[model samples]
Target: MEHQTIKRIAAFSDGGQGGNPAGVLIAETLPGEAEMQRIAAEVGYSETAFLAPHEDGWRVRYFAPEIEVPFCGHATIAAGAALAEQFGGGRYRLYLNNGDISVEGEIQQSLAAASLQSPPTRSEPVPEALLAEALALFGWHESDLDTRLPPAMAYGGASHLILPVRHRATLKAMQYDQAQGKALMEAHGITTFCLVHAESPTRFHARNPFAIGGVYEDPATGAAAAALGGYLRDRQWPHHGEVEIIQGEDMGARSLLRIQISDQPGGSIRVSGTARTIS
Candidate 1:
């Protein structure tokens, strides 16, 4: 039997040390669902995006090491960079199973920078029981949480629980059991728990426990970053208008993500970062 092949790329990093890695599989036609899942597991990244030619542009599907996801932002960025490298810097439209989205890539000063527009976003208040469980899992007390941000389940492309902590130290010391956390996330239908600490009006720090993706943590999460921007917009958080997210510091893999938001309500937000080839 011929095994399907896929390419791997790291997204949202300057030199590939601090970005979320994803597998980009481009094939004449997508294999069976089981085969895709098997390949994703073998690749062992947070998520793998598979692309196939379609009528409009490309039909895309994202699969984590464990399961298929509705959408994935970091992988989308990687896919965009991959496309730009192969075809030239330009915009690409993607049709996901859930909705339509777009990504753009360009060469800026000899570096590859890509941006992705997330799907429509929405948020819901976090339940008391769920909050308590999450705090226990991370060994954080209620006092550690930021009262201003208020915990909520936010979704742009995928669902994530956004919990703002009061202290940067609390955000830095993130830990959880893989099995237990995965069970909790699956039970709650969440992709990851986004733990954050605000550094300034426009800058923030983030840590994501992507247990559902069969990974202990994500170095950088574009989908969660987009969701975070939408959440802040909904609450009208004070900022310089642009949000900067710094992630993966605790893991020794530092990454940076920039989000641009508009004044319009429910407007699509842009997430941008630089990507370098891993090979």
Candidate 2:
């Protein structure tokens, strides 16, 4: 196989300072699955995106260190940034393993602005059995959860267990055993643990633990953000149309994600962020 050059970009950056890093590779042809996994592991980011020209638009695949995700938001944003640099700023259609989505990218001085239309979102009340295990993993009790946003399983391309806390302090003190988290997540097909605290109807704080992906945490998680937006819309949370999330501050990365929700339930949510090339 020919060597492919990887571009490292930080997606959802806050003023070009902090964000989640992702590796992006644009090749003439998509590499084999095994090779993509190896490259993603070697790159050692939360996720890596591979893109190749397809019959209509483009083929996109996301790989974590341990597995291939159906879709990944931060990596998609990073890929969009790369695409803009290479093919000019515009919207790019992407065909994923399970569905099709689009990402718009445009150069903004030293950074890039990217937005992704996620797959239709949905959420269901979490099973009692799974919720018990998740609470134990985080040493959180049911009372710790925000009554407004009950525990639920949310999906935006990938599945995430949403655990909205009542206080921001709870989000700041998030921790868990990586091995145990990985085991539980894998067993339940959960991609990440989306920990959140709502500052207001339109503002939130988040911390996503992606142990299933062999990542302790993600500074910025676009998929989870989109999923949360959908979940909130489902519950009729007073979002007023959009919500701004501040994530990774407790991790020192301080990333930001903006999610736009439509009136239609289970509709596609738009996740927007900025990307900066990693020097």
Candidate 3:
């Protein structure tokens, strides 16, 4: 295994305050899965993205400390920023294990910002049993749930369980044992548990439990944000075609994410945020 340079960047940052860290590696030829996984574990970020030049775009793969996920939005955003830094600002095609996506990078107010066009988005009602299990994991009951958003499994590039809490305090009090969370999430085949509170039809706050990937929580989750946007679109919620998300406040890494939804059914959603290189 040859040495691979890892670029560390914070995705979805808020004026350089808070964001999720991701490792980005751009190579002429990608290493094997085992080596990539090893590097991701060594980097110890929630996710790391490996990129290699393809015919028209780039071959991309995402790896957590423990496993390889089909897609990761925050990592993709970081990758876009890295591409911009290295190759100049432009849109880059990304080929993932599950599907293809695109990301655009540019300099915004002298900061690196990127937007990702997600894969086709969809959602389905969470089974009663699974919902109950999730609630138990969070130590919450049905009364804590927000009646408007309800509970469902949503997907943009990957899958997440979306649970809408009724109050902001409920969202802030989110806590869970990492081992137990990992078990529950793996059993349900979910990557992250998205706990959200709606400030308005177009504004939201979120907390994501990502124990399945050996992470306790994600400061900013672009994938989950895209999933939430898709769910809102699917429900015909009055989003006016766009939504804003504030996440990781409780973690002291207040990150920001913006999502734009298409009118077509199961259409792709766009998630955008600013990223900065870690010192």
Candidate 4:
């Protein structure tokens, strides 16, 4: 039997630490869904990206250990880095389940950095009841929220609920029952709950609870960061053109992400971060 290799890459890492691990398999052709699921289960990361040549670029699918997801940001970053290593750094088009996206990868010094153009983003108000449930799940009250940013459901590559907290300490102490959070997220059609603390107009800290995908938390969530950028753009926040996010600090991973939004409404947001291989 021929030996197969799956590259393990940490996306959005802070140098060598604080990034989310993703399995990247670049194949001549994609395997069947069952086989891909099996591979994803074996890899056991928050998500694995399966890439194969397609119409104009590559067809990509993301899977968690338990289920397939419509889109994933960090895995895309890892895939970009993997592609760069194999084919030399440049821009590549990715055909996802919903739409086409692009990632540009390059080696800067020792770190592999990639920036992805996310799908068009939009946001809507989160229902009061759902907001209350989320607050209860995190043991947070409305008073704990940052009044500047209201709770809302935002979508870039995927859907996420954005809740801005008042203090970094509150964001750091995020805790919830995995099973209960899974149920809530699935029931509410939310992929992740983005809990954030705004450090400044251009700086923020975030924690993502991704129970819908059977993960307790995500160290770095590029999709959520893009969604947040769109949300801020939609609200006309003083983003000043870009926002920087620090994640996984509470969990000691300390990942980093940057978001740049276009002035156009419902435009694709750019999410950029550095990736490194995990030995």
Candidate 5:
């Protein structure tokens, strides 16, 4: 049996204390799908990222405890940090199962700073039936939704249901039955439910229920965040070209993610954050 070493790193850390943890494996070649799946389950984190050198950059893949995801923001950030530590600071291209992206990383003040250019984004209005089912799962009323950002099926790299609440309290009170939510998400091809509140034009709070990936919640989700940025762009929300997201505070992880949005519709969003070793 062949085994590859994995590094545990947390991305989007708040002052080196809290962030979403991910496992990063970099080797000459990626492991077989079954082996990678087994490793991800054994690691038991929200996600694990694997990397191997490709034509001009690296091939990347992300896996959760139970299944694979199209793209994972935190895991990519962790991988970028790991690559920076090993090969020095620079921008690197990443080839994924469905797309290509780039990551820029550097070590600054003993922390890894990385930015990932997300896949192009698009959003669609949420179906009424799906919206109703989601509301029931979270015990929220339609009135609780923020009219500023209507619910949508948003996709940056992977798909997510973006539900913006009118109040921060509603966002904080998010809860759902894991099994039921998982079934609903899988049935609808949703990666997670990105429940959020707009604190201001430039600041937002988010909670992600990642039932499809077999996690109850994600402290920080870059893909969802990017999707939100793009969705806001589509809705003509006054984002002012940039936004900051504070997530996972309720779970004590306190992750922070910064995003830069472009004007072009379906443009790529740049998601950046600091990372540190879990250690």
Candidate 6:
């Protein structure tokens, strides 16, 4: 079957220097698994989101170069922006493999911003063995960890291992063998390894190793950022109920993410940022 290959633009940055890059593929009918994977691999972004017409909205699926993820926020934001630009600014509901989520795209004059609400979030304690393996993979010692945050596998739409480091330097100097890390992540059902360091009460630095996605690192990770916010809310971290994440600086791409947590139980946290089109 022939399908129209829509334009794919990288979002959430200025000149595509920062933020996670995603592939936005729009088609009338969904492609098969093998074909979708091929397209995603050719696109070669951290994640590629496929959108097809549904009853009233759209059905979306996110695929890394190698695997299909339950959901990907950066890709969703990028797709939303693409759709808004194509069909005009509005809200889009997406039916994902994991659950239903929505993204709203707005154009203020010439400036555009997109916000995505992630799936319900929850976190589980990181197993000691898993933590140790991850630490060894990154060549990090236990002293490098931020004890207050502890270690946990958090999930918003996809599962991520949150490893908070005590210092920015430690977070910056992270390294691992891509093949080995990918094997481990695939084996453990991990989408990304989120490395973070608190710079202040409300400011943080982040790095995401996305070996399983065929990327060395992500400049910005929306799903991971949401997961982190949910994790902090769950722990009642000593914050003012909001946080800003700066990522990709170490790689010279520089991305920004803003997260807001409410007092209500099981509330939908807000993840907002600016996205610029990258040709």
Question: What's the true lDDT of residue 72 in model 1?
Answer: 86
Instruction: Please write out the lDDT profile of model 3 over residues 1-279, one tens digit for every residue.
Output: 444578999999997778999999999999899999999999999999999999899999999999999889899999999999989999999999977999999876546999999999999999999999899989999999999888999988889999999999999989888999999888888989989999999999999999999999999999999888999999899999889999999999999999998888999899999998888
Error of 3 at 245 (Å): 0.5
Local accuracy of candidate 6 as per-residue lDDT tens digits, 18-127? 66777788889889999889888887888888999897789998888888889887888888887888788888889998678889887554445788888888788999
lDDT of 2 by residue, 1-279 (tens): 433489999999998799999999999999999999999999999999999999778999999999999999999999999999999999999999998999999999999999999999999999999999999999999999999889999999999999999999888988999999999999999999999999999999999999999999999999999999999999999999999999989999999899999979789999999999998
Q: Which lDDT value does model 3 have at 193?
A: 93
Q: List candidate 1 segments past 4 Å from native.
A: 1-5, 108-110
Q: Give the per-residue lDDT digits (tens) of candidate 5, residues 121-158.
A: 99999999999999999999989999878999999999
Root-mean-square deviation of every model? 1.6, 1.0, 1.2, 1.2, 1.0, 1.9
The alpha-carbon deviation from the true structure for residue 115 of candidate 6, after best TM-score superposition, in angstroms, is 0.4
Instruction: Give the alpha carbon lDDT tens digit for every residue of 52-123 in model 1.
Output: 888877899999988999988889998998888777899999999987999998765545789999898777
Shift in Å, residue 112, candidate 6 = 2.7
lDDT of all predictions:
0.87, 0.95, 0.93, 0.92, 0.94, 0.84
Name the runs in model 4 displaced over 4 angstroms: 1-4
TM-score of 5: 0.98
For each candidate, give its TM-score against the true structure: 0.95, 0.98, 0.98, 0.97, 0.98, 0.94
Where does the lowest 10-residue lDDT sum fall in candidate 1?
A: 1-10
